[model samples]
Target: MRLALATAVVLSLFTSPTMAEPTVKLHAAGSLKAAMSDIADLYEKTHGVTVARAFGPSGLLRERIEGGEAAEVYASANMKHPTTLATAGKAGPVALFARNRLCALAQADLAVETETLLATLLDPQVRVGTSTPKADPAGDYAFQVFDKAEAFSSGATEALKAKAFQLTGGKDSAKAPEGRNPYGWVMESDKADLFLTYCTNAVLAQRDVPELKIVALPEALSVGANYGLTVVNDAPQAAWQLAVFILSPAGQEILASYGFTAAGAL
Candidate 1:
């Protein structure tokens, strides 16, 4: 009877429903923290699985993934980073999950709009801020917007780059005070008069400080940001399930609520 009981216990351990679920490790971009965290919580509540998340600049996270840090899912601020991972055999196929556009966040009284945008940044008295290039996709897109700015007026790219302050997003950007958006924090601390960042981020910051305004970028200088999602090459089944959920209507709805556009809506 002891031998039979021991055999039954071993079989039960293998077949238990509670033990069937797997915990997935998700490495995602900093901008995704809010939306992804909420989605993960909802997913766990409904599926009885857990999601472990690590958030940082997409490029830095991609480097870690390339270095073989154990992650099951990768969501990047831009499609290029995930595509690079897949090209290096570190991740699976890349999927464009959402899109964003660059906008200017300014003090309540700052005179900045699409019409006066370029002139304001060019003014020496105006303090312009942006993320750090290469280290963060937001910064890279900011610079790309500057490149487009060159079209409206010659040498606008170099001029904007020279005047823009690398304030919030960087390889060594300091953590903002708790419950504060980095851009808003910088603006509130008098570090910058205008900050160029994702439109979604601008909206989030406005929630923290109602006085902050989001100025739309003109079509000539607008830069579109594409968010990508991919599973690691050896990711568990749960990772793929989460990825599918993100692409599902429910997930898309959550993203839309957070100011993100449908993947092709740009």
Candidate 2:
């Protein structure tokens, strides 16, 4: 009877379901998708923990976190969003993980260069595209470029802002077909002649549309972007570990390969 009872107990133990592995939820900017996905894969392989990732506009992600969405870590295109969360006690201290810069993605026929970027953008017939400001940091950076343009040519800022189309990264923005780059799709669809976005994004867009031209912003109108990262308050230790890995040399190397200026280099 004792032997039979012992066998039954062992059998039940073998049939019982094991506890689920720990998961870290990460909310990050859309621009970080490719690099972050790679980083997550490496971390999961090394630490044996699952990383659930969600990517979109940084500002929108911040709003979601603010509205009580569950996120272990938040990565933003600008420090302002994560810093705001830290200020509100929703997240931990903000840290700079990566850096980027603004560039112009222009249609093939448009004759634009760094020197003539301002004139090309301000041209009455040209249709300029930008991300939605306040909903996406890309738009804020584009507008910052416009602000710098004001110094070179009076009213340049107003002219550029008024004519720019808020195409992507907005609540009502048109959705790109699956497997399509949003910026490339928008430009290819004749939505805009020129679009201002992050240099990394512009590179991706160019990859999507081989003929598309990426024009560097002139020195006078240049805008540098700083990406911030933070873990939500009370998150598991694994979340902090993930954040640390993102700032580590291995992760920075991955980001740099994607055209981002790593935090260490920045």
Candidate 3:
């Protein structure tokens, strides 16, 4: 009896009563930073699972995943990247998680409004800033705006595309100073007189630089963004749970507070 009890104690010492919770690895678009941080915190508190997150341009993040980086979940600023992953069998089905629209961030003294927004962007004297196309969805959306400009005037697309400065979202783009919004920092540094970016990003930029103005794109030029979420193939169960929670009402509320149109609402 004494020998048996000692053996039992040894086995107990090597085994845990409950399995350790898994950590979920999430790669998401930079635009989702503020919202996803809150969601991750809430998920940790409620589910007892830690989340490791990486944020950047959605297209770049997708490229990292395609290149064999270990990401259990992916959230993108547009459906294209995540859908591409899903098509490649790298991830599960894509889901629309959020929506956003474009707006122009202008210098405090710049004269811009919905009525003259196109003219302002076309003016030879104005310096237009944009994210790098194909590497960032914001830049793609800006170009889409330029495409729509063609309906108003011929040769508008080429002219706007030629003058636009690709200042951010590329691999070598300058990093903003610590604790500074990239958009605000760029404007403060006089990188451009009018920068086209997501409306939500514009809001954050304005918060950082109160003097900056956020001008809404005219109805004719407005372009909407669709955010996508997916669970990577072979990801642990915790990843699926986290993805579900992001689509949950509670998660949607957090995103909505940050100016995103929640998936359910759309």
Candidate 4:
């Protein structure tokens, strides 16, 4: 995707001795903080602009927009929120920008074998953690994993459900705690015994604490989490420009480098 960008000029009207650039505010997924910070610096240097950012779970970001939050560009860990906004004519059609996967991250010594990840979560001694399902793909993906396991191994499923304590499954699961996904409870940093997070978030969190070990989900149960970005109908002018810039090859390259799967691979 090639975009024709306007070139910059050397102006002496310099209050800052450089081009006075427009600043854009971006609301992004919390898991994307590391990669976004790296990408933002490169973008700011290339385009002579500044990108101010706020990061959190996708669900929180979505509700913010629905309630009339002022964000020109909205990027989420999943495409659904953007699509919901687009359907209501609040945001542009969604563009899948990148993708990630859910992984179980546990203390290094407590890490379980790959083949037993699902079973390990069921063990009473092993406490598993995850994000809020309605608000996070990782949280929902965790439920899918458990439900799939439930169909194949009823006892394991039941035991794990008991251990997990609060899942909100499709219908049978509604009885789950009002805001919790039994298999993967809605958790953030320090919110659970074992955090269920995307690979990116795990990587970023490790920079703060190095004791965590990432456990890959079983292939039969896990699904990839795709991310998307779009321009909100009411975004400010600067936000629009930054949104456009992020859709280009330059932005995709940065996203892909940080363990994200990019668009067009299917």
Candidate 5:
């Protein structure tokens, strides 16, 4: 069944496409699922190539490349991470794709605003969850939130740590001390009061979970996170084709519709 499912989903690649396209495998950031998938389908239709995406934390994906997991194109949650991957010889020249901000979000049924969300995370009543800094770019971005809170001063790290019951989050947290993690740890949970993540994640989450409320992040505390794309070692031609398509105007338009901010535009 899994094989059949895979074949059907990737059926476009096996058949000869009009654009002389090849099948490309893409390893992308977890936060990019919605935007990337939307662009991928359009890219396949226009370019006659199929792009298969494997989404996960950027840090771990970089590690996968370092450990020799073969890939073609890599899209990271933050350019810094893909830049780091390039530096470490795991990737190639990366181009900026889109930018997002760190948003403190919760269920609309609650009354947590931006200020209240941050305060609540620090309060004993809130048990915040964030992706692990070592494994996910969201974790690093989350830490940056605290970094901004302190103006990069002392005690910021510890204070951020204290705002949570656990530092580890996402699928990899099974390897962590928490051992059990929720599927969707919204900021306003029945048991907790605050959660932190990127606005990109919220955009994707809204597709299925419409009750999510967005907390307005203060300009002083907010950060613009960039998504980056790069070619990997010895990847197929289809990868390059998809990469070009993503950089094209059509692809950019699709991303913009999903709240992506182009770096060069600013």
Candidate 6:
């Protein structure tokens, strides 16, 4: 009778739910939402561990983590942010997980051409929307593209910069109007003639609003964004698992389907 009771107790301890993997806290960049969400879902289904996510501009997310916010994983839109964290001893080594490019998103009727993209942006009647620089890598990339515009016309860089409105994609952007896609809502509301954002985001917007057009930037005027990720220094073991999964072949497939290039491809 005593042996049987001890055997039952040992079995219960082995089967306890507490032995399962712990939930992972994930702080990811806004541009990676769809891909990361899909990966998290898949991971949860197979691993029995939840991934709690908080998405925002990479720079702001970094700021939060640096300001004592707790998260196990940090995925950034650019290499600099994650590298910064690792250098400060907050995270592990950074890895380039994905890549994207800057593009212009506009309503169907807007006439934005790759050949005259800078000229179109400079037109007095045209209003442009851009993310906030220093706070978001998308905005920083947009400014880099603007710098490339200088070859076509002197002062074109500053002129385009001055005219561009910091409408959305900022750390403090207004809650997207209820029931509306933030990108589409801003464009439909006439906030700007065109929005400069990631090619992946433009792809998503056009999928939701078929009438929206995605205008590719001229190759010379385009800037590629490198995405980086790292596990926080004190992260749970599951966090390291997730970081590895994102760099795995299956993870790269999901990101590719969402319009991002694998970091290895770039």
Q: Give me the candidate number with maximum TM-score.
A: 3
Q: In candidate 5, what are the lDDT values of residues 34-64, reduced to their tens digit?
A: 7788888888887777787887788888888
lDDT of 4 at 34: 66
- Alpha-carbon runs more than 4 Å astray in model 3: 1-20
* Tens digits of per-residue lDDT for model 2, 1-266: 22332243344345434443489899999999989999999999998999999999999999999999999889999999999998998877788889999999999999988889888898999999999999999999999988898898899989999999999998788999999999999999999999999999999999999999999998888899999988787676677777877887888999999999998722
The CA-based lDDT of model 3 is what?
Answer: 0.88
After TM-score superposition, the amount by which residue 121's alpha carbon in candidate 6 deviates from its true location, in angstroms, is: 0.9
Candidate 2, superposed: residue stretches over 4 Å from native: 1-21
| lDDT tens digits by residue: candidate 1, 162-263 | 998987667678778978887778887888899999998898888878899989987778899999888777565667667777776777878888988965
lDDT string for model 3 (4-112, tens) is 3224334433543334346889999998998999999999899999999999998899999999999988999999999899889887778888999999999999999
- Distance (Å) between predicted and true CA of 76, model 6? 0.5
User: Which residue segments of model 5 deviate by more than 4 Å?
Assistant: 1-21, 151-156, 165-171, 174-192, 264-266
* Candidate 5 positional error at 96, Å: 1.0
| Weakest ten-residue segment in model 5 by summed lDDT | 175-184
Span of 10 residues, lowest total lDDT, candidate 4: 1-10
In candidate 4 the C-alpha lDDT for residue 229 amounts to 79
Estimated TM-score per prediction? 0.89, 0.91, 0.92, 0.76, 0.79, 0.90
C-alpha lDDT (0 to 100) for residue 208 of candidate 1: 79
Instruction: State the displacement of the C-alpha of residue 187, model 6, in Å, after optimal TM-score superposition.
Output: 1.0
Which stretches in model 6 have alpha-carbon errors above 4 Å?
A: 1-20, 264-266
Residue 156's lDDT in candidate 3: 93
What C-alpha lDDT, on a 0 to 100 scale, does residue 30 get in candidate 6?
84
lDDT accuracy of residue 144 in candidate 1: 92
**Model 2: lDDT of residue 161:** 90
